[model samples]
Target: MFTARRLSMVAAITAFALMAGCASQNPYDPNTQAPAEGGVSKTAKYGALGALAGAVAGAAIDHNNRGKGALIGAAAVGAAAAGYGYYADKQEAELRRQMEGTGVQVERQGDDIKLIMPGNITFATDSANIAPSFYTPLNNLANSFKQFNQNSIEIIGYTDSTGSRQHNMDLSQRRAQSVATYLTSQGVDGGRVSTRGMGPDQPVASNGTADGRAQNRRVEVNLRALPGAQGATSTVQ
Candidate 1:
């Protein structure tokens, strides 16, 4: 007989496989939301896949009563979905508490969490090096990230339109990588993290004025939960 833990692992793996096969684009990418073929949300589609996987796992696990095993497997997956939501909520609350008074602003959007960190606090002008003062907050963030280890992290760096586009892009990439390096050095899983540089793009404010330019040169960290709370988080390595 298969253990419940083994069944859950199988279900998660199967659901992810189904999602990856069905969508040409990445379903778990934070930058894009791929449309479903029949108006079904990705979550719903994956939920159904998980159910199917559970049914299959349950049947295989229970030799004498396959039907009963299938039902139990599906129920277990449903429960895991609910559990994921609960943990997500707790993680958001903990992040908000930890980031309070730290120059970082935590914003929750749907199932995703965004952290905006101003450039002045994160680095010196035209430099990719992290400011010494910012280390404490980054450390705190690393602790929270380790505690809530199921979410994939995306660190995006941006810059004002001051220098050549190529220069800005390289600087931005270095800045993003700097943050990623610090987090991983603090024991956060490196495999769960990715970084991108969007130089002089998607500015939150106008670049004409000093204040607007200040706002434009900043970094954003986005956290997106992976499927199945019981499964370890994995993303681009």
Candidate 2:
């Protein structure tokens, strides 16, 4: 007769095997720059881990009815894990759809989403004003931000190492502020938005060449879910 402890151990091992064996089926690879086309979602991975832990706990606690306890435990914990990532996952997917072909890149890093906007499309040379052509895209972004109100937005501006450090710093600050202001004007909650200036630091590419300098001069918008807003949803469409 298999003991309750042994049964639980077997369950854990099986789940682990499934998780590992299905690696190729996992959609979100933190190492890659692009989203996978077809695979198990990251939320499922978390649920699997949760189920494993829950099964062990449930079996250990309910000696009289270990199997039933394990089932209930796995269901509860797995559901919680799946729900935890739902908000961000949905938001990321929507943002990707929203930003398609707009020259902005939507990247998922853990639970956070980042939007990278190149300098040429965002701003004019040495100017804090936003380019006229970018307004529509900014409007679209503001709409999405308004829909995903649970997130705190941070806009960071970067400049090429072409000018004095202090000057670049100020320019970056102004550029970031400009974006923030525009978003707020579009009815995005100003309270959730903040801006910073990196001042020619954290270059995405070498500044020695014109192409690299162009790439380096840009802005990044990072969205992180507020602690209290986990699993929260908005009615905005």
Candidate 3:
């Protein structure tokens, strides 16, 4: 949950940032670079890269069994969040169809799937509570995940470059935990789910524009393969 004092401060910072109209860049992405190519949002690219980086970091910490998603650490960086190429193509197709026009993007990265939920649809400014708009799409995804129990999910939360680093990071962390809690309540196994807060480190859009900031503040769920997914969907369309 977001505290009132923190929210007030973040809201103040956000209001000022919006009025100024320039996005600040943390240590990861500099303000100078343009939007990423292939029309892929920097959020997804950076997230995937972050997930990969996380994997490497985890592997460093636990060299014996790096395949575990929990070992990715709290940061959840890197593209190799987990080994890919296990989910079925038809399942991905179904997920794509379900997410169509829902403002929830379904992106297939090799054997993994990334469902990107932008802030406008997930949460209001400076808050971590799940918004009503988030339910419909998540319910739809939850249904799919219930059937695909063999898959492990990594939920990463991000924010725009409006507030202080610590505040933004804390907000992002709470948001991720909220989403994870809701999903578990919806029947997605809590054990297979991991949450990480990337803060304003991975912006999909420029923090400069209101629309860009809206897109940058998001939660991305990456579905990865599990080794013993006996009845799991593994076909690629």
Please write out the lDDT profile of model 3 over residues 1-237, one tens digit for every residue. Answer: 334653344344334332222232111122322323353333334434444445445544664554442234313432222112223334565777778778998766655668899999999999998999998888998888887666789999999999899999999999999999988999988899999999999688899999999998999999876766532323332
| lDDT of model 1, residue 148 | 82
* Winning candidate number (TM-score): 2
Better of 1 and 3 by TM-score: 1
Q: What lDDT is obtained when candidate 2 is compared to the true structure? A: 0.76
TM-score between model 1 and native: 0.65
TM-score of candidate 3 relative to the true fold: 0.61
lDDT string for model 2 (98-165, tens) is 77777888888767889999887898889999998678779999999887788899999999999899
Ranking by TM-score: 2, 1, 3
Q: Please, what is the whole-model Cα lDDT of each candidate in the order they appear?
A: 0.73, 0.76, 0.66
Check candidate 1 and list the clashing pairs. Answer: none
Candidate 2: stretches off by over 4 Å: 1-40, 60-64, 229-237
How many steric clashes does model 3 contain?
Answer: 19
Q: Which sections of candidate 3 miss by over 4 Å? A: 1-86, 230-237
Model 1: per-residue Cα lDDT at residue 14 = 58
What is the Cα-based lDDT of residue 17 in candidate 2? 36
